[model samples]
Target chain A: MRVSLSEFRPPREGAAAPALRELRDEELIERVQQGQRRAFDEIVRRYKGRLNNFILRMVHDPLEAEELTQDTLIRVYVHADKYREIARFSTWVFTIATNLVRNRVRQRKRQPTWLSLNPAPEDDEVPLDPPDPRADPSRQVEREELGRLISHATSRIPEKYRVPFLLREVEQLSYEEIQRVTGLKLGTVRSRINRARARFRRHIKPLLRNEALLAELEQIEARLAAEEGSDSDD
Target chain B: MFCRRARSFISLALDGALPADRTITLTRHLEGCARCREYQTDLQLGRRLLATSAPALADGFEWRLQLRLNRTLQEAARAAASAWDAPPAGAGRWLRGAGLAAVGGLALAAAVGLFLLPGEWSVPAPREPGVPGALVERNAPQEPAPASAPQIAIVEAPATVTSTAGDPTRTSVSGQSRTTWFGREGTGRAVDLRLSGAPDPRGLLERQGWSGGSLEDLRSIATLRDQNRRLRDALAQAQREVILLRAQSDTARGGLAADAGGQREAPQTR
Candidate 1:
């Protein structure tokens, strides 16, 4: 009598982890639906970066993002029965993440109005210096700082446009996927993403000192417009 | 629409979200408006910067989430199991305990009634159907069951002891319940019960050093035969007198003293 209880438990992450990692995303979800906790474990491990990035940009705090990301996975576990297979699993899962991030934003908005009492987080911490004097790391350090600036700028985008924008730009979700995750109309997805880009450009334009990149962008757009001629989707 | 509406479309155009029909309108406006063209270049730069600089997640995120999930599920299962196993609080707990005990006691009693009753004692059995119920009841003794010791009858039969087998008490091979008896010496020639088919009694008297003899033989050997005979006859005579006196007393309840006086006078005259 081989009892099923022990086998049903998702295998611990030691010997069986590599095999679980090899399973496809939907296959993992199917396993999870059949009560395999390790499958969900793999799903959480796979999507942490993508979900954490969107959540961190939305909530503007790393700790809350981590917390919300955990909350999203838990909701996925609790509501595993309701997942429909016809839909893309990522769309359904990111929708859960998006909804949690939305709720967290609403909760933060409900806090006390004494903004001065809640002092803004300090941002004056210095970046760690390169250790070796001969390490020639100036370019890497500069690029890191630029990346930090870009993250800060993206975080500042308005709440309405922020989620759809991150879904489109950072997560690379299709427009329809952005609509599904954020539960917005197609037009809303388009307009919010556009607005998000315009605001992001306005914020980051003064930080960079690159004339050639801007000139190249203009040449490319002009050439594209010229090539299209009279052909139009309309 | 002039650069005002076209400005919004510059972003959509950069993202290729603009309808093909609206592209011409945005394009003509952008061709005339250098300011909008500059805005478009800035938008593209910002898009490139965001796409390139999207931050990586913190390390060990999945490991932490897995631990938390396992802990939560274990807690939920424990809570559910306890709720199922636990009886209600207060009076219901006491009531349930009492009810379970009562049910167990009843079941045990029922099992005893069903299987433990004596089968041979109840109702008339097939072997004793001719025996009257009253006679059966009258003969039934209110005494403890007798021990398994073999009873020796002190009768005057001639000694018929069987050959001394290895063990007379061994009844299994013989297929009979009786044990072998010992014969008295000098009581005439002994007849072996093996030929006579008389069963041995395996008497305790035989096991002791006492002679296996009838009461008459024992009395004669002790030289008290006449005395023993006389005592037995005297006891029987006394019992007969007692019975006659009881009959006379019943007839002459008030005439007992008068009859005694008349009998004395008659004896004097004679």
Candidate 2:
């Protein structure tokens, strides 16, 4: 028999089903453990995009990222009973995603490549979003180039350092949280992140010293300071 | 703070992980050192760029995931249902599962008995000299056997053979015939099997191997025995069902006949 997503919700709570979208990750997971299928759907909705983006950056292959993201969610669904409230839901989910990506990376290393009939573009060809019509064309171009450079630099970071680096910079996770997620000692997490930032700067060192960009940054800083001063006077 | 240590602290400060005093010192160092100020600005810019660099998610991602989850759930459900419907294993099946280890044990025992102590055992004497491959039982008259028959060298000690209700010919003692291929290494010599007073090794050595019979023969016998028991159970169930169906048919026919008789009498009385 075909199992629908709605099949798992307990009957008595169906009418009184609360707004799962409004609930926190931990609360939703608790509901999921109780077999509330909507809670699981909500969890999937919440993490699928973030997980996919994170995995894509790590693996540099969108198709593999999508597959890994699905696998991660499926793992969460199947092993929902194993989850405890000891850590944030995001940390646990990211840990699962990182492990899946690590395995994929290892397998890729072993086999490496095959003779393709056709030359394919790089796996991580950045899909640039449309530029704002009102924005300056030169500035938009600079932003796009900088974004591409940053993405390339981040991917260039050694996997050990890159993981904690991305967790800190992109996902904005704390060092302690990265430690928990990566199962690394706090010192290791801090050091890796430190090394990753230094490496990232070296990759874009030329851009950091570019006179035009530096001048623009100075202008923006001055503008921000002037706005703060005006606000203080008011 | 040294520039090297300041850079590390600057990275930590950006993440809000460095202590307040260290942050104060790093801020002061950045103010004094142009290189450190540039390093902090570059790091900030990199972090900002990385934040906005998230690639667009593939379309229909969630739809695809829903399909996978449904498939997974269905497979798990099917597995559980089949497990629930499966019949519990019976004694014959259990013996079949352990049939290999038992065969190995028997082979080891037979090898020990044949090589170690040949004189103490009573080797069955060939009573009929004319019969070539004829098997002669101890204390029983020998019957002539075909040349194609298996040759057995059996040493019997007081052993009890349990007879099954269905097949008397396949009793536990029939295990003797299966030992024929053990020693047929070109000399046409038969392997000598020693039977003790122990309870019959149930179908352990009863069946003949097809071609220089391997341990597979024992496993096949066990499997066949299990199939036989299952078939017998099915037959009994079919018989019980047939009886119940026949009784119901007879009752229905009796009611119809009574109704016909009453209608005929009503027409005559009218």
Off by over 4 Å in 1: A1-24, A35-42, A111-144, A210-234, B82-270
Worst 10-residue lDDT window for candidate 1 chain B reads B186-195
lDDT of 1 at B112: 34
> Model 2, range B109-209, lDDT digits (tens) per residue?
43344454465322333335355544322332233342331222232222111222332112122432322221111111122232222222223334332
Q: Which stretches of candidate 2 lie over 4 Å from their true place?
A: A1-18, A114-148, A207-234, B77-270
Q: Write the per-residue lDDT of candidate 2 for residues A123-217, one digit (tens) a residue.
A: 44333334435446565555456546656777888999999988777677777789998999999999999998999889878867778866765
Question: What TM-score would chain B receive for each of the candidates shown?
Answer: 0.31, 0.35
How much native contact recovery, as a fraction, does model 2 achieve? 0.36
Q: Best candidate, TM-score-wise?
A: 2
State residue B159's C-alpha deviation in candidate 2, in Å.
19
Lowest-sum lDDT 10-residue window in model 2 chain A: A8-17
True contacts kept of each: 0.35, 0.36
